[model samples]
Target: MADLDAFLRDLAAESADLEALVADLPPQDWTRPTPAEGWTIAHQIGHLTWTDEVATLAAADARTGGTTFADLLTEAAPRVTTFVDEAAAEAAGAPAPELLRRWRHGRTELADTLRAVPGDAKVPWFGPPMRPGSMATARLMETWAHGQDVADALGVHRVPTDRLRSIAHIGVRTRDFAYTVRGLPVPGEEFRVELRAPSGELWTWGPADASEQVTGPVLDFCLLVTQRRHPDDLTLRATGESAAQWLNIAQAFAGPPGAGRKPGRAG
Candidate 1:
């Protein structure tokens, strides 16, 4: 079982870190365009805020035996062609201060509600249902990924921290899902992944003696998996054809294939 408390704590830390980045920005700076096409720094934070609200609703519903989360999705499905972008765009229209306040409150509510959720409860999401621990990790992964966009837009270089382990973990865990969603056959054999963390500790996944392997610095791997950096811009090495192919399509987020950053875009 996951250490739920630990995950929640890390999620809080991640949110605080991102919040610090934008909290002091002039209101006009929120309109700065990020790497994501047509998305401003406000859009990045807006997306995170909107997602936190949705997750809070899901966790609360699971705890109280309510179906508002599912019902809302069912109702929105037909009317919204791309709900994620729509939500972000709508939230982005808010004044920067108001948007920041909403994000802060929404994330806090989500963390509190997830704590009250039963240990085995599955929370409804855009993809499969997730346990509280998985939900926290997912939130952290996104907070970091989108935070990267904000950081890049501001030309800020954030030092890698151990919190990235959550993103890296999800990147490895979702390997098969990456393949399946891309309409490609999942690799038959396990592929080894070995990443060296910022603290100089090694974090590894998959079986020993695996024929295919990926090895690199943890930061580069996380950037690759999150599609924040083009493959050519990363130092990750793939020892087999399967591993190489996996690198091309790797995505830590749960969604359709992402339009990864173009080469030379990494800062």
Candidate 2:
């Protein structure tokens, strides 16, 4: 059974972990451009902060259905690329300290809201509502993903943690959705995925003997699915054509297909 309390605890840990590195940045570093296109470190934090507020609102409301997060962006701006540009533009002018203040307070409130919501209650989101457990997991995944951009800007190495198990699990579960978002047909057959978790334990999903398979370090798989790193840059192996193809364009988050990092060009 999914432990909502455990999930919330981990989610808080992720938030705190990222905030530590960000809290001490020198003033100029706030405007440093990260690997994520057109996003300074401040913009990345701003985006996360903005999304956090929306998530908190969704959690408190049971009538959660409307434009998905991606669609919400599209509706506000013509291209997904520009969706966050406007917000980032305005935020860039704020003092870096203020930005951090907003994010810190917002995330704490979001976590509190998650803890108060009943486990089985649906929370409205960009798309269909997610149960509290799923909502918490999704928040953790996004935090880690965006945190990667922050880490890169600072040129700091982040050690893999067992919390990645949740992220990798979501990646595996969303394999078909990865293809679907791109309007590609999901492979008819199942593909097994085996991961070596950070703690040296094997975390297996799908079938062990399936013809199509993906096997690699949990860290690599998580980065691939989050579209933070191109599959070619990782040590992951794909056994069949379907699996190989899936690796090329895998995306775990909801949205239009992300223009993932390019081979030999990841920032």
Candidate 3:
């Protein structure tokens, strides 16, 4: 696991980078359709902001001694889903500046809270009680993933950095999230992942002797796992059945299976 302080800093930086890209968009662009079906840029950002609030509540619940982390997620799932729906509806026609302000404010609060939380503090997630560090990393993964959709829709590109370590961590650990989503037993074997970061450095995880391997550029791998970019659209190369199959349903963040966009639809 990554050092908690470093991970939180990376998460905060990535969120700021993503927000900067959309903060000055024209009002028309805010309403432009994204690769996500029936969702615009506003919807994507609103979803991120909404979930940040949920994280806050989950963290609070964990500290107060009310419910198990799993139970907290189970109870809050429907409410968060509904909140995202209502937020998207409300922001559908809001001005670009107002939408940007709201996103920034929400994300700022989330980052601050994440940094303040102790590393070992457990927080409610879809499956287990994640440490504060792990949860912060998960949030970073979501921001980067959704930011990809917004960037793709706007014809911009994000040069992902080594900070992607946080995302890579979640992607590897959440292999079970993929299995659970498909109603399958979690694979017993680990797989090796070898990726080239945007800065051209290599990042690897899992046992080297494992029968599976996922290799590719860091950004492409992130995009693929997040379901923001289809694996077929990127340079990801999976060797072995388990690795390939895992790639098909990889999701680092918490949530039900997203209605993943089809290949070539966004391009």
Best by lDDT: 1
Question: Which clashing pairs does model 1 show?
Answer: none
Off by over 4 Å in 1: none
Q: Give per-residue CA lDDT, model 1, range 164-195, as digits (tens).
A: 89899999989999999999999999999999
Candidate 3 lDDT at 256 equals 80
Question: What TM-score does each of the candidates earn?
Answer: 0.97, 0.91, 0.86
Q: How well does candidate 2 score on lDDT at residue 238? A: 92
Score each candidate by Cα lDDT. Answer: 0.92, 0.84, 0.76
How well is each residue in 1-267 modelled by candidate 2, as lDDT tens digits?
248778888888998999998888898999999888888888888888887887887776643443454345457766555655667666666788998889889988887877777656788775456888888889899999989999988888999999999999889888888888788998999899999998999999887789999999999999999989988799999999999999988888887788889787557
Q: Which pairs in model 2 have colliding backbones? A: 64-124, 68-126
Task: For residue 144, give model 1's deviation from the true position in Å.
Answer: 0.1
lDDT sort, best first:
1, 2, 3
How displaced is residue 246 in candidate 2, in Å? 0.7
TM-score of 3: 0.86
